[model samples]
Target: MLIEHLTMEEFAAGLERTRTVLVPFGSTEEHGSHLPLDTDTMQAIDVGRALARQRPIFIAPPVHYGVCRSTFDHPGTLSISTETLKALTIDIVAALYRQGLRYFILLSGHAGGTHMATLTDAGEVLLQRYPELRIAVVSEYQLAAESGRELIETAGDSHAGEIETSRIMHARPELVKGTAPAEYPAFPKGLLVRDKRRFWPGGVWGDPGKASAEKGARIEALVVRELRTLVEQLEAWQDS
Candidate 1:
């Protein structure tokens, strides 16, 4: 159920029966020319809602800002430091844990390297403080990358490419407009610090034109199925 819609008593009752909480985490970043800035957030909430339909869980409001330093140069990309993200995440977990929620599934839709690292580190700190709590943070795209590789024909599914575009098409078709032209800009082989704008000039890494609502539906189903397995794994740890 959506936590925001629940009254305090209802929420407490939900917590009493349901040990797991699903937190949709996303980013406000430029998603090429076709998709909207809230693409990640929309996709994340979709996943959370789908998962909640299959299991009894509290769906927390989505986290919209994330670590996007690489893409910050692109207009409309909102970013926060890794440390800030870590602290915010830890605080959120602590607050929820106080409500008797023992399991947290941070369903991230963003793929920033620092973002993922910060989430993992925050979960670690939460576990240290509350040894009884169990947390799992992961991205739906990463989970589908292994099995849905064939579905992606764009340069790559890293950014607002085929997979992401398709996901949006399936979730919210009216939001999509003309797509950015496909370009495969490569970065320096040995560069330690690279600029996303230089490597991906179009702000698009893959061919979004290749995306279709049919493919998007397929991808969404695949991600949800994989996430269900992950949630089950987390649930298994609740009583241990």
Candidate 2:
């Protein structure tokens, strides 16, 4: 269930049963000219909600803004520094740990380098600080792979590509501009490309023209299935 909608009493009662909280992290950046700026947030929320239905989990409100330096060249893309992102994550995790929540599963929807790197570092620190707490970072692509690779056309190139575009089309069809001319920008070779210094110019790395609602539904199904497996694994570990 969504943590923000619960009353204090309700949340307290929930803590008695389980201390795990799932955080959906996303970015408010350009998802090409076709998809909405909130595409990452929306997809993350959708997956989080689906997972909550089959398990006793609390879904935190999405972190809608994240590091998107590569997309900063595009208008309307909001990005934060790596330091800021790292600090914010540590603070949030520490607060949750104080609140008696021991498990924090971060479901990140952004592919930005700085954001992911900061989260990885923060997760490591939080784990060391609170050994009793369990933390897991769920990558949508990884989850999808566990189910099946056929769900995605181009495995590595996911941004605004067939998989992501289809996902947005399935989750938020109205927000997708189906008429936009699709293009797949190439990445330069031999560069230590971080999120801030990407090779692509237009923020689009794959061809989004193949995106369709049908494909999107398939992708969503795979994500949900894999998430169910992850939750079950967590439950088993807790029981053990």
- Residue-wise C-alpha lDDT for candidate 1, range 37-112, written one tens digit per residue: 9888888899889988988888998899999867887889989889888888988888888988888998888878
Candidate 1 accuracy as TM-score = 0.94
How close is every model to the real structure, measured as TM-score?
0.94, 0.89
* lDDT, residue 36, candidate 2: 83
lDDT of 1 at 133: 93
lDDT of each: 0.84, 0.77
Q: For model 2, how does the per-residue alpha-carbon lDDT over 28-47 read when each residue is reduced to its tens digit?
A: 88877788888888888898
The residue-level lDDT of candidate 1 at 180 comes to 74
**Any idea what lDDT model 2 has?**
0.77
Give lDDT: candidate 2, residue 84: 85
